[model samples]
Target: MSTVNPNPSAAMLVIGDEILSGRTRDANMYYLAGELTKLGVDLKEVRVVSDDKNAIVSAVRALSTAYDHVFTSGGIGPTHDDITADCVAEAFGVSIDVRDDARVLLAAHYAARGAEFNAARMRMARIPDTATLIENPVSIAPGFTVQNVHVMAGVPNIFQAMVASVMPTLTGGSPLLSQTYRIDSPESTVAEPLGDLAARYPDLSMGSYPFTQDGAFGTNIVIRGVSGAQVEAAMIELANLFPRG
Candidate 1:
């Protein structure tokens, strides 16, 4: 009998000095997480690194090795600080330059818009030799995939578009099922029973999120599992144990 893997694991690397300095906030990780969850690719980790080449290269190498898929956002623009392509090339020990196809794409895009395809603008075409291009429908400047690492633009809309382009190509697993129950009690009051319930359902993931609403404390219990029946069973037991007062 063949065994099934419920989800393929993934990690994300957010690259930019702007992000580290709080000048720009990252929305890609949030979008990627939701999309991956629905697609059944578990996003296990996320790391943010600055524009430094060493930092980007190290993170790329580490994440690519640790996860089934690695997605990187930012630093692939036409400015001096855009160095993600070079860093990714270094990480994989591959040669990189402005590939003809990528250059042609950008050149045509600029020409149609009556803009200059200057040296700085051409920087977006620099891609590692052994990589395949990830199409960018929002902007003509394409992202690329090197081995298991996918490099995408930093702009939220562009990043989302790139993710859309990349999603169809990946192999997904069984959808993760979940249920949530809100208890009008503090975490302190719910901890012992919740722990006991969690212990009984080893295959399911149970989490308690505490909130303060209108001067009252409450906990939201979320039960998640690949098997809907198992999640429902645990949820039933949890409701029974902690009946709403």
Candidate 2:
């Protein structure tokens, strides 16, 4: 696996009224989370906001400053409600205009179909003046990158392609390593021991996921750490605490 010396932290912004209304489900968050983890970047938070201009602007401003990288999905489409590009520009105190590269790509896409380039279609070409284009293989409407913010498509396929395009250019940190063990015991019996283990390993994250199987309640203990050695050490210590199956 490819790893970096210093890990980066990231956050995602999902902007769409459809998502807020439960009309459309979001698929980008999980995909990005897993991808970033493999790249050694931790996904810190995710926010789902409506298509309101103020909301988008506020989220963009906050996330851009807070995370090493901020990815925004949705609101980059060719419609009046697709105000993400403009909102991002305003948040960054930059201008918004039809970018030549984006326009060329979008124009060619429509022209190939012998379709008219109307105002609706032209909206997709509007990009932040200080941003660079992120190529969209699924569609010609390119995503944009400004500072720490990466604007991408809301559609899963297009968004994923854009992420793939940008990931290669980013700097990553040490990949997190994790281990899971199943214990045929209730959480109440293991909570105190887990707590002690967590306190002993300050650098590791310990979590308990409880479930019921075979008409009995049990908990799955997961330990994660940036260092494989540390995680392995913690697993050994945890196993010693509960030697029997």
What is each predicted model's overall lDDT from 0 to 1? 0.92, 0.90
Lowest lDDT block of 10, candidate 2: 1-10
Which pairs of residues collide in candidate 1?
Answer: none
Per-residue CA lDDT of model 1 for 26-78, tens digit only, reads 89999999999898898989999999999999999999999999999999999
lDDT of 2 by residue, 1-245 (tens): 12233678999999998888989888899999999989899998999999999999999899989999999999898878899999999999999999888899989999999999999889999998979999998987999999999999999999999999999989998888889988889999999999988988888888999999989999899988788998899899989988766
Backbone clashes, candidate 2: 1
> Could you tally the backbone clashes for each prediction?
0, 1
Task: Tell me each candidate's TM-score.
Answer: 0.96, 0.94
The model with the greatest TM-score is 1
Q: Indicate which candidate wins on lDDT.
A: 1
Model 2 sits at a Cα RMSD from the real structure of 3.0
